[model samples]
Target chain A: MLRDALLIAGKDLRLELRSRVALNQVLPFALLVLVLFAFALDPDRGLLARATPGLYWVAVLFSALLALQRSLSVESADGNRDALRLSGLDPAGIFLGKVLAVATQLAVLEVLLGVGVAVLYTTRITGWVLLAVTCVVATASIAAAGTLFGVVAAGLRVRETLLPLLLLPVLAPVLIGATRAFEAALAGSPSEGWPWVGLMGVFASLYIVAGVFGFGPLLEES
Target chain B: MTTEAHRQDIDSTGSNGTRVLGIAALIAMAALALFGLVLSPADANQGEVVRILYVHVPSATVAYIGCFLTTIGSAVYLWRRSRWWELVAYASAEIATVFTSIVLVTGMIWGRPTWGVYWVWDARLTSTAMLLLLLLGYLAVRRLPADHEVRTRRAAIVGLLLVPNVIIVRQSVQWWRTLHQKPTLLANGVGAKIEGLMLFSLFVGFIAIGLVFAWLLIHRFRLAWLEDQLDEAGLDVAIAERRAEGAAS
Candidate 1:
């Protein structure tokens, strides 16, 4: 299963690297979101700084949506879905591989966004460890949930709109937990942030297990 | 079966059992309105605003029941591929969404008079709102045009996910609320004392709402079954027409 996962993950990442869609489109779109938040909230009054954690995660969430759509669209075209089903690979491995690819993309986005928040919002992060842990756990949670729903929405004509409708509500806990954790880390309160990390961990594991089991049937359906 | 007889069979999604259940629900609902509106005394603190609790609390309970039923139906459908369980899941989810909406609106109405606002980030309200959105997602998936089997499988996955989603939402919202230390309006809203008549009225509300839920579920399931039959009949007609055209050519 692990070998199959790596193979699929490598294939997706290679496709992404060759395509450069993430670098050219999703990254700029995420940064644009940061800039848009600055415009929406006046930066001079320190409101933007206070809301940096939430704004950053919201941007990540939106970008994750695009990334998930892209990930699903990769197989959605050219009968790749059918080919993959007949590829003699385990369905659970495919699920984890897709999750890994998305999480890797999200992690890179997070690093860039972290820099963007630091520069654009002039936010100082005191708890680096807490900040890093939150990103890893929260990104895993988002990617696992997003990948599961991505396939669910993949074969539908209204998939573009339906994916978000089906996914965002389920990810509400992630947004809440990640934002709170980021707020704590940025505010130099590591103790307060740890619990939120725990919540994110729980969410990540729950969805990962769910995706592993649920993906087989969903893959066949899509 | 003859097409005419099949048409007649699918004409009405009703039976004697459902008629009896429907009549019982109507009677129970009428009694609930009478006891809840007239017999129940005003709360010492909340006064008239407290009356909404008759519908609000019962609706919330029924909504949870709907959620539970959907989970069971989804699980059984996935395990056994039973169309009956799928229809049960679909019907219960729609009803749950309706009841959850009622819970939200009534909670807001009660909140306005009691808490000076129509909304609050109280844990219950926030989680209930989240659940409504989640159910909407499930319904949205069900509405997508697809092969019937594909659609059912997709919806079942969403349905099964609801349990964990609800638990996570509730827990995270509770933590979100407590972390901020906002004054909990919900705690004060329902903390008022309930004596004999009000208690009895609330009990009547439960019976009324539960019966209404059962009645809706039966009717909705039958309607879905009829829809499936119609789709099959339509497919048969199309296939027959195509065959006739091929023969003529």
Candidate 2:
């Protein structure tokens, strides 16, 4: 199962690297959101600095939607879904693979966004360890939940409109937890942030397990 | 005889049992109103605003029940691939969405007089809002155009995800509220001392709402069953018509 997952993850990441969609489009869109936040909140008044954590995660969440859409859209085209199903790889492996691929993309996006926030919002991260843990856990949570719903919404004609509607509400906890943890880390208080990381860890594991068990049936149906 | 039996199956989405349940719900609702509004004494703190609890709390309870039913129905449907369980999940989800909406509106109404705002970032309120959104997501998936098996499978997955989502949302929101050190105004309003009639009113509210929920569930499930039957019957008719046309040509 792990080998199959690695094989599928490697294929998706390679496809993404070739396509450059995430690097070209999603990355820019995320940075634009950060800039837009600065404009809306007025960067000069210290509001951007105060609101950086939330705005950063909000940007990431929106971009994650795009990434998830992109991830699933890959399967939708050219009968890839049918091909993948016929290949006899374990469905659970496909699920974990897609999650890993999306998480890897999101991790890179977060690094850039961290830089974007630092450069644009003049935000300084005081708790580097706390910040790193939150990003990894929260990204896994988002990717797992997103990949799960992405498959659920995959082949439908209304998938474009339906994916966000289905995915965003389920990711509410990740948003709140990640934002709170980011706030704690930025405020130089790692103690308060650790618990939120724990919460995100719980969310991440729950959805990962859910995705594993739920994916086979969903993949067949979609 | 088989055709007659089939006709009887699809005839109506009601029965004597549902009629009894409907009448019982009506009586219970009436009693709830009397006990809640007219008989129950005014509270020292909230006074008239406390009456909304009779509706709000009961609606929230019914909504949670609906969520539980959906979860069970979805899980069973996935396990057994039973259309009956799929319909149950779908019906319960729609009903849950309605009650969750009611809970939100009534909660806001109660919040206005008690918290001096129509909305607050309190954990319960935030979590309930998210629950409403999650239920909406489930309904949206159910509405999407797909083959029956495909749509049912999609809806079941979304329904099954609700429990975990609700738990995480509640926990995260609670921690978010607490970390900010914001006072939970709802704690005071609901935790206040309840005397004889108020407690009785609340109890009556529960029975009334639970009965209403049962009534709705039965009718909605039957309606969904009828829909499935109609779709199949329509397909059969279409196939026959096409064959007749081919024969005539």
Per-residue C-alpha lDDT of model 1 across residues B60-176, encoded as one tens digit per residue: 999999998888899899889899999999999999999999999999888888888998788899999999999999998887789888889999999998878999999999999
In model 2, pairs of residues that clash are none
Q: Which runs in model 2 stand beyond 4 Å of their true positions?
A: B1-11
Model 1, residue B73: distance off in Å is 1.2
Flag regions of model 1 displaced more than 4 Å. Answer: B1-5
Docking class of 2: high
Give the C-alpha miss distance for residue A87 in model 2, angstroms.
Answer: 0.6
Give one clash count per candidate, in the order shown.
Answer: 0, 0
- TM-score, each model? 0.97, 0.97
RMSD (Cα, Å) of model 2: 1.4
lDDT of 1 by residue, A141-208 (tens): 99999999999899679999999998998999999999998888877778998999999999999999
| Leading candidate by DockQ | 2
